[model samples]
Structures are given as structure tokens and as C-alpha cells.
Target chain A: MRIPLSITDNIQEWLVSMMSESAASYVAMIIVALIYLGIFAIAGLFLVLIERRVAAWFQLRIGPNRVGFQGLLQTMADALKLVSKELTGTDRADKFLYNLAPYFVIISALMALGVMPFTKEFQAFDINIGIFFLIAISSIGVIGILLGGWASNNKFALIGAMRSGVQTISYELSVGLSLLTMILLTGSLQLSEIVEVQKGGWLIVQGHIPAIIAFMIYMIAGTAETNRAPFDMVEAESELGAGFHTEYSGMKFAYFFLAEFINMFLIAAIAATVFFGAWLSPFGITESIPWLGVFWFLAKTLVLVFLMMWFRWTFPRLRVDQLLTLEWKYLLPINLVNIVIMAFIVWQKLIIQI
Target chain B: MGYFSNIFNGIKTLLTGMSITGKYFLNSRKGAITQQYPDNRETLKMFDRFRGEVIMPHDENNEHACTGCQKCEIACPNGTIEIIWDRGIDEETGKKKKKIDQFVYHLSMCTMCGLCIDVCPTDAIEWGQNFENSVYDRTALTRVLNEPESKVRAGIED
Candidate 1:
């Protein structure tokens, strides 16, 4: 697949020609890293505020609209408070692992963010194995949850972490399978390539029933993978007090909190890219203006993000057994059948190609 | 068929739940119950019958209806009301009359039960709906109902 030339690509070429190729590449990596960090912080703040406001609306209350201009800076203020808080650990806790776990979770989420195609040319690493890399890195978040729980020396934390481990492992299959269903349609694993294929229409509209089923399955599994509510047995405040990060305080706790929202974003972004057209304007309305691709991508991602938030507010947390049953009994089987069906559709050339 | 129907039912119920929340989310413009507190203070009036605090109303001449009646003080379960009274000469009649020196209301201690207001014979005390009564000091919460240099209404002398 030929890489589409964008402003950033032009800058990269100029830098490589002017400087040592290796040094220029290193600088480019650093630049992308810094951009992603800024994005993570802003998106984390925005998503948390949106979640709180949406939850409030659903429950007939006004959420945090006091800090700055309808509570825009509420998360920023919360981050400050968390940073200033005293870092406390239990007496029997393994201090090293307890401190290290949050970074593991945060880094995994950050790695996933790196590969996402924000616009036609605006991607950090545009890897050929984008979906594969995303799936692989996202699974690593469970290790942090496990380590935090085990190191806490608390029974509730252990239970929460174990539930999280079980939940993530079970749902990951459905996430992969659903993506595979779409990958069959696109015949490419590259994020940009997958997106380029959607110029005909979105995979959802192109493949119809199978693609829609894949989307539904992906959403359920992705919500569980993110450890969000209805599937949030991991942090079930009513059952296990604060879950895996029970003993963590200060910025370490903030990392775990922020990472959840960031992961929620990655899930939505992926959904927008693979199933919906990544940065493709609906009916190519704004195709002439390349910069508008970023707008189209964000508008699509926000819609999916809103859907996830709605799920969090509307649905009750499933029990540990119920959570497993939901994935194993319902989602997993449906996903398997859906994939076979999608393959058949692709082979028969039933797709509504433009 | 049963297996597929069960899956369909599950999806249907989940969609049903989503629709309900979707209705609230869309209807939020009219359905939002939030009373934006400080911002709405200008128009935010409490109900007429709302019991917030016990207050004694005074007219333009600074004359109150309370004639040192000890009934309110006795009716108060929390010992919240303290009426300090002394015998004084009534200027018009040249006769000794019981007069109130201080009507001390310990607002912090008062339960806002309205019993004192109910027991008042002169109907001097009524529920005040000014609920924003937070104070910095405990002593600051102890309020004097009667204005300085004010006397009881002449008609209420019994």
C-alpha cells in the first residue's frame, strides 16, 4: 500500500535529507511521542467530563459544571489534587511492583494511541500490522491490573484483579474475531489501508448485516476490555473497595484513572477507523479539503465514544459469573459464526462495492 | 429457533434499556432537574410554608409582637429559645409591666421543628425560608430577634 503524502510526510523527508537519517527518525519519534502525550492529557480530561455530564443527564442531575466554563477544567483540577496527595502503600505491600504497575497500564494505552490514524496523513507510526499491534498491546494492560492487585496485599484487590484478568481474556477473543470479520472484508491489516478501503462507504454500510453484527460484538467486547461499567466487576466499588488500585494514592492512582478514559478513546477510535470510515467524509462531501479528514475522524469517534458512555450510564454492572457467561455463552459464539458468515460474503462478492 | 430467539430477546431488552436512557438524554433540555444554586439565587424563592428558621417579624417602627411570652421558651424541646425579661414601668399607664430584654435564639441548637412557633400566643414567630444560615463561629449563630431600642407593640400588652 502506497503511503499518502501529507504535510507531516513532507516535513519528515526534508528533515531526513538535511540531517543524519537515523537522528532525523529519532527526532520524528520524539515529536510524535510529545504530540501523543498532549493528546492523551486533553482527551482524558474531555472524556471524563463528558462521562460525568452524560451520567448526570441520564440520572436527571447536572454534573460538574462549576470549575471552569461548565466544568471544563474539572479534570485538570482533579489531576492537580491527585498529584499533591500523599502516596500511601500498605505495610505488607511489595513497594516496587505496586509503584511499577500503573506505568505498565498507562504505557500499554499510550502505545495503542501511537498507531491510530487521526487524519489521511497524521499517524505516529502507520505500521502495517496496526490491528495486530493494537490487540497485542491492549492485552498487556491486564498485567498491570494483576500486578497492582497482587502487590496490594489486599483480598478485595486480588479478587478485583482476578475478575479483571478473567474478563479481559474472555472478551479479547470477541474483539479480535470482530476485527477479523472486518479485516476479511478489507483484506488488509494496515490501519491506513483498512481506512482507505472504506472510501466506497463504511465497512458497516458496505457489508451490511455481518459488519453491523461485528460492530455490536466489538462494542460489547471493547467495553469489557476497557473495564467499563456493566462489565466493571474489576472495580465494583460496592463489592471490592477501589479494586486492584486500592492501596495506590496520588499520581499513581491518577495514572490508572486516566488510562481507563484513554483506553475508552482507543476503543472508539479503532471502531471509527475499521468499521466506520477512519477519516473519510460521508459521501466525500469534504474530500477536496484534506484537513477536514481530521474533523470527520473526530466526529465519527465522538459518536462511538458517546455510545460507550451511554452504556456505562444505562446498564448495571454484571456479576462475575454473569460477565463470563455473557462473553463465553453469547458474544464468543456469535462472533465465531459472524466471522464465517463475513468470510462467505467476501468470497461470494456480495459486498456493495462503489 | 429457541437459541436464536433468546439472543434476539437479549438484544431487544438491551436496546429497550438504551432507548429509555436515550429518551432522557434527548429530553434533557426540559427534563434536567438541576437547580443551579448560586446563579439562580435571585429568582429562587422557597415555598411559603417551607420551614427553614424561626423568625420574629418587626414593622417600620421597630415594634415586635412578642411580649416576653415564656410559652415559646417552654415549648422549645432543645432549650434553643431564651427570653430575658425584666419588670419595667409602662410610660402611658405608669404601671409595672413585664418586658423582654433579650430574645436569644441559638440557631445552631434549634432543630427547626416549628414547635416554638406553634406555641407562641402572639404569633410573633414564623418560619423563615432563608436557609443559607452558615456561620463561621458558634457564638455568631446565637441571634437576637428584637431590634435594639425597640419596644413591644402597645396593643399586644396583656
Candidate 2:
């Protein structure tokens, strides 16, 4: 197959010309991984600032605008402060797992960033099982929260960890089923193929009610998966004293904090890629400028991210039982019915053709 | 049917909450109540009667109104005010009168209760309305209210 002249392909071509094929591919992989790491670090800081500012607006207060222009350096200053702090853990805590937990969370989040098709040609790895891989890897992040909580040897952290474990497992089903409903319409699990099929129009537009229903379910499940408000039982500070990572301090604590924002960005990016056209401009007006694909993709992802932040600030945290009931009783049944309806629509050729 | 209704009600409530926050967010341009403090100090104005600190009133001629009766000193619950007095000859009356040599106000100790202002027979002390009271040292806070080289106004009875 002739390789498309994308950014990744250019690097691959250069490396292959300079070195052996295997070495080239290996080097390219390392480069892409490093790029994703930087992207997550910057995106984490940006999303936190936006979330805080949006939250301030919701509550009729001005957020941080002092550190730099409009408080842009606030998160940077925060990162520096965290770096300077002494890492502290409980005396009886399991040292090994406590040190390892943040990596579990951060790695899963960064790995998800690699698969996202930023533009038509910019995905690090366009694996055939894109959606499934995303779902699998993203769900593993809760393991870090679980380990962090358990290793702390604190009851609140342990309870928080257990709650997160139950919450993620239950919510994963709804997230998977909802995405499955969309997959039925697209007939492909590969993210680029899904985005390609939506060239007819975004899936939410073409597939009608079932697609919209799937999107809503996906959003709710995604929010829960990220451990955000309304489903933030894992770190319900008022009740659990920051829940799972209660004993974590300094840079260790910052890793968990940064991972939460990075995970939020991943969830938003995935939703934008799969449901909305990943890099497609509205009405295909900007289709000629393929490089503008990155801009379009970021715009769509940020809008979704803002929507999630809105949900976070507006809604209160759910009780643990209520959270479980939300997934099993409300979201799960709706997802099942929605998938069936999507199947019927596809079988009958009721999907809108461009 | 009841199950569906319950779900609908739950969503409706959630939407209602979102709308309230959305209204505030959208109207933030007009509704933001932040003063931006130091930046707005030039335009910011305190209420006319807001009691911020104690000050002895002086006229343009550098003559003060204090007779040093010590009523304010007596009325202050916190002992935040001290009146130093000495008998002096009134220029107009040619009579010996009690006049304030110094009116010492320890702003650090002042509770801003306005009792001294209320009990002043000569209406010498009143609220300054200057609330920026932070100082580098405690001694800086202890202010002498009377301007240097000023005396009690003539024709004012002791």
C-alpha cells in the first residue's frame, strides 16, 4: 500500500532512508510517544486553567488572572510549587505500589492521546481496533486510583479506591455499549474509517435519535469514567478527604492531578473523533486545507471539553448508591435499547445518505 | 411508564440546574462582582458614614477642634485613644483653658467601634473612611491625629 504523505509518514520515510526499516519504525515510535507526552503535559495545564476559569464564571467570581496574562501561568506556578514540595506518604503505606500508582494513571491517559486522529493524517497509530483499544486502555486508569488508595493504608483512601473500582467497572459497560451503537452505524471500529464514513455528515446528524442518544450516554459514561463531578465518588473531597490519593503529597500528588485533566482531554478528543467528524470542517468548507484538520479537530474537542466542564460545575456529586444505579438502571438499559434501534436503522438502510 | 417518567424527571432537574449556572456564565460580563481591589482603588469610594479609623478634625488654618476633655479617652472600650492636655491661655478669651498637646490614636488596637466619635464633646474625632490600614511596622499604626504646629480653634469653649 502506498503511504499517505502525512506528518508521521514523512518522519517514517526520513528514518527509513537513514537507517534499517525496523530501526526506523522503532525510532518513529519513540518520537511519537515523546510528542504525545509533551502534548498531554501542555493540554493538562490548559484544560485545568479553562476548567477553573469556567467554574469561576459559573459562580460569579473572577478566576486567576494574576500569575501571567489572564493568569495563564497559574498552573505553571502550581507545577513548580508541587515540584518543590517534599513527597510524603503514610508511615505504614506500601512504598512500591504507592510510587507506581501515578504511572498507571498517567501512562493510560498518554497512550490514549497517541491513538486520537488529530488531523486526517496525524494519528500515531491507526490500529484497526481503535475504539476497543481506547476503551480498554482508558478503563485501566482506575487501577491506578485503586492502587493509590489501597497503598496509602488509609481507610478513606481505601474506601475511595473501592468506590472508584466499582464505579468504573459499571460505567465501562455503558461507555462500551454506547460506542458500540455508533460502531454499528459506521460499520468500522477504526477511528479514521469511522470519521471517513461520517463524510456523509457527522454520525449524530446522519443516524438521528439513536446516534444522539448514544452520544449523550457516551458523555455521561465518559464523565463517570474520568471520575469528574456528578460521578466523582473516587475523590469526593468533602466525604472522603480526597478519596484515593489522600496520602499522596508533592510531585506524586501532582501526577494524579495532572492525569485527571489529561484523561478529561482524552475523553473529549475521543468523543469528537468518533461521533463528530474527527477533522472534518463544517460543511466541508475547509476540506481543501488539510492541515487545517488539526485546528478543526482541536475546536471540536475543546467544545466537548467545555461541555464536560459545564456539567462538572453545574451538577453536584452523586451518592455512591445513586452513582451505581445511574449506570445500571438508567444508562445501561438506554444503551441496550439504543444499540438495537441503531441495528434496525442500519439493516433497513434508514441512515441518511449525503 | 413510571420508570420512564422518573428518568425524565431526573433529566429535567439536571437541565434546570444547568440553566441556572448557564445564565450566570452567559451574563458574567454584567454580573461579575469582583472589585479587582488595588487596580480599582482610584475609582473606588467608601460610604460617607463608614467608620474606618479615628481622626481629629482640623480646619484649613491648621486649628483643631479638640479641647482635650478626655471624654473620647474615657468612652473608648479598647483604650485606643489617648488625649494629652496642658493648660494654655486662649488668645481671644485671655483665659486659661485645657488644650490638647497631642491626640494619640493606636490604630492597631482600635476596634473601629465609633464610641470615641460618639462621645467627643467637641466633635473632634470622626471616622476617616480610609480603610487601607496595613503597615510595615506596628509603630507606624500608632498615629498622632493632630497636625504638627496646630492649636485648638479660638473662641471654642474648653
Candidate 3:
């Protein structure tokens, strides 16, 4: 059968071959899934290194220069150390739940990879509900934190978990509301659809004043949701004694650490997809280049991730009350009202006319 | 009326806050405030009052003026110093000399507490202001600063 030819024609043919007389498509999909997981781990390692470097710059000191070649392999060494060390379980705690929490966090973060369309041909699943699916899966990492905290039977851990729950739930509303503004403008739930709309230009550049404002709102709320600094009160070292993971030791603690970094990348990647254009370049020029979309997308996300790490190192963690106030008093009302106005403007076709 | 004005004032305040950041961001012609250290250590000089490595005062013949009083040793809480003593043979008076012997100062164990200097009676010790003391071996850090016999004799006669 003759297929309608396009730029992804070669990719389509390869996928079709996998479906005929073999379990090749299933095997290929698993390989692609593992590739995405590898990307997550690699990104997490780089993010951890970047965070330390930025922190060193902020505090006017050199950081982690002793590890492999200006600390390039610091994360590798750290992971090896964590793996070799003991993973202790609390005697008083529910052993099943305690053992289960880190897995929950790691699995959910890995699940977020399924919805992310790395390129048109590079996605694991071409699901229609990709954006919301990402949001849903990534949020489960928070439940892991709460579970780990509660199961440990440590007072500080419980308090930290409580803080994380409140913070996560609060910031989630602002993020949702900010992103809702974009969904209203673009009129799609799927991330691929959103990227399609931004074929001409990234949303940050294409959409006028209101869209830019929404982008800023999303960035701030996403940073908080990632539990990075300025919003890192959940694990405020001074206040809560390592917060929710206080009772955790060795490998279980390592899982929690890895989860935090992966979530940071996930949020950044989602932000790249939503506001900056997933894998599209300016003026729909990427259609000619074939791979420019994915390149531009990864580059943009890495830049955003670096900026988030910079913010983490530059500022002291905000007080819990101050954090709540920023969300409730400022971000919430602005995003809520902004979406309503954007909806009206989009419906009337005022965006193009004006 | 005043409360409504406060909202406008709030907007103005935010703009003002943004403008300060704006000015700094735009002023790229100005040199960056960051300094890459260790690379630029050749021209580095500590401030006048910066406390760094400790030095013992030496006589013209290269000898320290410390006696075996062990006051500084007593003042050091971390036991970073070990003052070994030996009876001095007197050629004229035929009596033991109350002079310092082996003055061992361990840099590894040093907390940079200046209490030893504070307790010194001879005004022989002061901060060296030389802090590039990273050595290859731990044993190299354990300094044994004893006066040579010739210099000790010259100090006693003087």
C-alpha cells in the first residue's frame, strides 16, 4: 500500500514495519521509553551539578572542585556512594508503605516521560491528553513525599510532609490557572496541539502582553511546585532538619534526591512545551530543517532549567507564611482573572484583529 | 480615597523595584563583579589585619625568642602544640636553662585560635599572613620549629 509521503515518512514506515508479523513495535517502544528515562537521569545529573556551581557562585566560594575533573563526575560518584551505602527502614513504621514511597516517586516521574513529545516522531505515546497526563503523573511525586514523611514516624519528617502537601497543593492551583490561560488561548489539552499552534512563533513571542504575563506566572509557580529554593521551605535545612526525608537514610534517601532533580527537569520540560514551544522554532522555519524542532526544544528547556537552578542558589528560602502569601495574595488572583480575560479575547478573535 | 491611592502606589513601587534591576542588567559595559580565584592568587595580598599562618620571631642568627614556659601550650584547648623540654648545660653558672626546646606546632590540628599568641610573654609570635599552606603530606603539616644550638647560644649571650 502506498503511504502519503511527508517529512516523517521514513519514521512512519519504520513504525509500520514494527507492527507487521513481529513484536518489534512493542520492543521499539520500550527502547524509546528507556531512552526517555536515560534523558531524565542525565538531565538530573547536570541539574545537580549546575545547582552546586550556582550555589558556590552565590556564596562566594568554590564548590565540589575535588570530584572528577572540576566535579563533572560528582553526581556519578555520589550515586555510587549512595548505592554502596545501607538503606535503613524505620522499626516503628509501616514497612510496606515506607519501602513503597520512593518507588512511587521514581515511577511517577518516569511515567511523565510517556506524554512528552520529544519530537513529532520521538514521543513514546501519541496520546491526545498529553499535557494534562504529564501534569497528573508528575504531581504524584508529591504524594510520595507525603507518604515517606508520614511513614517515618519522625516529628520533623511529618511537619516537613505537611509543609510539602500544603505548598504543593497551593502552588499547583497557580500553575494550573496560569497554564489554563494558555489552554484557553490555544484551545487544546494536548501538548502536541499546543506546539502546532506555535509553529509560526513561540507563545512567549506570538501572544501579546497577556500571554507574556501568563508565562511569567507559570515560571514562578512551576519553580515553587518543583520545591526549589525561595520555595524550598519543605526541606529548609535550618528550620526542619532536612524536612520530610529526615528519617530516610542511604539508598531510599538517594531515590528521594533523584526524584527531586527529575521533577525539576519535568517541570522545566513542560514549561518549554507550553510557553516556549515544545520543539518548534520561530516563523515555522523548523518544518524545512526536520530536526530543528527537537534541538530548539531541548536547548530552550536546558536554558530554563539552568535559570531555575540559578534562582534556587541566589535567594534564601522564603518563610512558609511568605510563600503562601505570594501564592494566595498575588499569583492566584492574577492568573484566575487573566485566564478569564484571555478566554474572552480568544473567543472574540480580538487577538488577531487588534 | 487613600486606600485606592495605595494600590496605584503599589504599582509605582513595583515599577521602581523593577527599574533598579533593569539598570544593573543593562549596564553590561561595566566589568562583572565576579572574580575567578586561585587563578588570580599571584597578585593576592591579605588585608592588614587578616590573621593567617603563625610565625615565631627569630634573632639575627635565626633563632626564636620563646622560652619553655608552656603558657601558649596551656592556652591551646585543642592540644595543637607539643613543647618538649631538655635541661640546658650551663658552661659558667652550672645550672639548667629555662629555655624553649622542641616547639612542635601541628597545622592539621590548628583551629586558627590566636590564643597562643595572646598568651606568649616574649612577644615572639605573630600572624604570618601566608595562608597558601596546602601541602602534599599530612606529616609535612606538623612543624617542628626549634632554635639551632648556635642561635640559642647567641640569644642567651645577648
Candidate 4:
């Protein structure tokens, strides 16, 4: 029998025993929110440092070695500098929307983090429809980009925002269908249930051929969704001079920057959970050590994160027309065919079991 | 068939590109092209032929080869060199001879063209490798190449 190591559940029971039910829930909610906020900030900072270091290596340069042991404190120094900078905007810009845009992006990313199964029972909000919740929440971040671009009163920013809207809408279809392909094998929307299903073998192994295809498509679409490079027409630095965030300065810009890295982490986390067996050790090597699940989960997620960074530094940015052509002409059609194939394999019960 | 081939070829090229970068990344410590300037000052050496500035070399007896012929002063395109001369009695020959009282070099006006060094009849001046020429005061750049009370070498011919 498998050991039940539910730390969050234990916390909930302890809180309920100490106080009235409603009061305990209120305190628990606040505590969980604060903890997630801390995770979001720290994860974003470290991802930025990792991205710079990886990029430096790919280009054959020593990146940021002076700041606190291989540039560990570089992002902290950058964040501090950003926090103290003057907040500036165009004189005639839409003040209300301009101020509100960053919150929409950051909050959506934080909400998506809520459902991530870092380990058994470690998730903050174990929603029943976890995959659907993630898809829905991720799409909301594009609205913030659109709003920030439009309210800046700059033509380039507006153009960038519009391109972002178009790109996200097109890529969202592939991301959804790819996940839908995997959902056929697992037959569940809950992330925790999905991980439990992978106890026998990872969805990638059991669902083999089509699962690999879906993963490839998912990675491609996910990179586009995050507005990262090779698909970074949204922030086409050479073309748009920082794109949608051209007018923003200081902490407001930090919110947009941090939200991006957080979104990247979310994409990698989702891929780890759904395809690579979330927190499950390979062949249950550490079955008795339940806490080791967190370690396994993060290790898998960071490998995928490094893969995304590799893509960012390796591939050149796609042109605007080329970007649309890729999603519509290439990715979407392949994605549709891949899902049907997955369905057939599941129906035939041809999956490899451990 | 053509469509499938096109996609396959595209993916192949992308992998090729990734392999090149991946190789570099793995060997980054050995492959980095950047030279940390100030940190590597101890090992930094300028090429021997690098024209930094003109310097007049003196012998152990505080004697130079310059007869104050003013050839460098005439060859200097920017008027960077000036020589002050005096008629002095040559002790060995009992005859009057022209000798430089002051051999002033204005580093600020020099373009490092090496024309003055080339025109020197007695090989009085040669290039110095000290290129740290920055100075706060403009007058500090003007230097006298000859030491005080120094004379031309005994065996030097006019």
C-alpha cells in the first residue's frame, strides 16, 4: 500500500481543530496567498538569472560572475534598482488602465500557480477542473498586454499589443488541443488525479507515439503563449523598442517582467505534471520517501524550463507573417491529427503499461 | 510527399543549429572571447612596433646623439616638437657647434604618425610603449625629452 503524505491536508485539519471552521479557513486562505506570493517573486527572480546565465553560455561568454557567487544576487540588485526608479508615462495616456494593466498579468499568473501540484497535497487550490482552470487563467494575461499597449498612447505599443492578441489567440488553440489529446488517456481534468494515474507509468510512456507529438506541439504553442523568443513578435525589441511596455518604468515594468518568467515556469510545470509524471519517482524508486516528490517534480520542471531557454537562445525570432503561418498552417493541423491518433490508441488499449 | 519532406528538412536544420550552440555552451569556459581588461593588466603586453609616443634615449654618461639639427621639428606635421639650441664651444674640436638646450615634445598634438622618429638623422627618438597618456591638465602633457645639463655624445659626428 502507498503511504499517504498529505501535508496541506494535515495543516487544514490542525487549523480546524484549533478554531471555528470558518475562521480557520479565512486564516488558511490568507496564509496560502502570502506563501504563493513569496514563491512567485523568488521563482521569477531566479528564472531571470538562469535565463541570462544560459544565454551567456550559448554565446560563449561568462555571464554575470561578480554579483554574489556566479551572479546569484544580480536579479535581486536589478529588482531593487527597478523598485527605486521613477514611474513615468506619457502625459495624455489613459491613466486608469495604464495603472491597472500590470495587476491583471501578475494576478492571472499567481492564480494559475494555485493549482500546480508541486507535491502530493501541496497544491493551494486543488480545483476539480484544474487543467481547464489553468487554460482559462493563462488566456487572461493577454488582456493585460493589450491594455498596457493601448493605454500607452504610442503607435508601436498599440501595434505590439495587437500582434500579441493575434498570436495568443492562434496559439491558444494548439495548447488546448494538445492537452486535450493527453486528457483522452488520463480521462480526468484534475491535476492531482492526473498525477495519480501516472503511478504505473508516465503518460508519455503509456501513451507513447502520439503523446510525444502532443508534447512537441505543447512546447511550441506554450513558448508562443509566453511571448518568448523565436515567437517574441510581441516584444520585437528591434522593431518596437520594447513593444507594449515602452512607456512603463520602475516597479510597474517589474510586474510585467516578473509575470513573464512566472508564466514560463507555469508552462514548464504543467508539462511536467501532465506528461512526465508530476512528482513520481522513476519506477517508484523512492516510494517510501513521499517528501521526495517535491524534489522530483521541481527537477523535471527545471529541465523543461532549461529546454525552453535553449529554444529562446537558439532560434531567431519569427517574422509577423511567418508567426501566423506557423500556427495556422503548421501547428494547428498537426495538433488536430495528433489528437485523433491519441484517441485511437486509447480506444485500442495499445498503451504500454509498466 | 514534398510537404512532408519540407517539414523534415526544416526540423533537421533547426537541430543542426542547436547542436552548434550546444557545443559552444558545453565548452564555454575555454571558448569565451572576452578579455577582462583591468583584471588582466599584469599579463598585458603591447606589441613592440606599437607607436605609443616618442622617447629620447640617454646613455650612462647622460649624453644623447641629438646635435639639435631640428630635423624632427621640421618633419612634425602638427608642430608637436620644438628644439631650443645654443652655440657652444666643442671641447675636443675648439669650434662652435649647435646643441639643444631644450627638446620639448607636446604629446597632446601628436597623432602617433611616427614621422618625427623617421626623420631623426641621429636616431635620437624612438617609440615608447607607455600608452596611458591621460592627464587632467593640458600643460602636463608637454614634456622635455632631454635631461638638464645633458650633452651630445663624444663620438657623434655633425
Scored against the true structure, residue B6 in model 4 reaches a CA lDDT of 76
What is the TM-score of candidate 2? Answer: 0.82
lDDT of 3 by residue, A1-354 (tens): 432223234554587776762354445555566766788777777778877765565444566766889999998788788889877766799787888888898889878877776777666565677777877787788899899889988888889889999998999888887888888767788777887887656766656677887888888888898787878877988888998888888878887888888888788898899888888765566678767767877888888887676566545678889889878877888788788888777777667411
**Candidate 3, residue A217: how far the Cα is off, in Å:** 1.6
Residue A155 Cα positional deviation in candidate 4, in Å, after optimal superposition: 1.7
Question: Residue A134 error for model 4, in Å?
Answer: 0.9
Model 4 quality (TM-score):
0.82
lDDT per residue as tens, model 1, B81-129: 9999999998988999899999999999989888999888899889999
Best by DockQ: 4
Q: What share of the true interface contacts does candidate 3 keep?
A: 0.00
Error of 4 at A231 (Å): 1.2
RMSD of 2: 4.6
Q: How large is the interface RMSD of each prediction?
A: 1.0, 0.8, 6.4, 0.8
Show pairs that collide, candidate 2. Answer: none
Location of the lowest summed lDDT over 10 successive residues in candidate 3 chain A: A1-10
lDDT of 4 by residue, A179-253 (tens): 999999999998999999999899999999999999999999999999999999889999999999999999999
In the order shown, the candidates' DockQ scores are 0.53, 0.58, 0.12, 0.60
Candidate 4 chain A, run of 10 with poorest lDDT: A1-10
Question: Per-residue lDDT tens digits of candidate 2, residues B111-132?
Answer: 8888888887778778887888
Candidate 4's C-alpha runs over 4 A off are A1-7, B45-133, B138-158
Model 2 chain B: weakest 10-residue lDDT segment is B149-158
Q: Best candidate, lDDT-wise?
A: 4
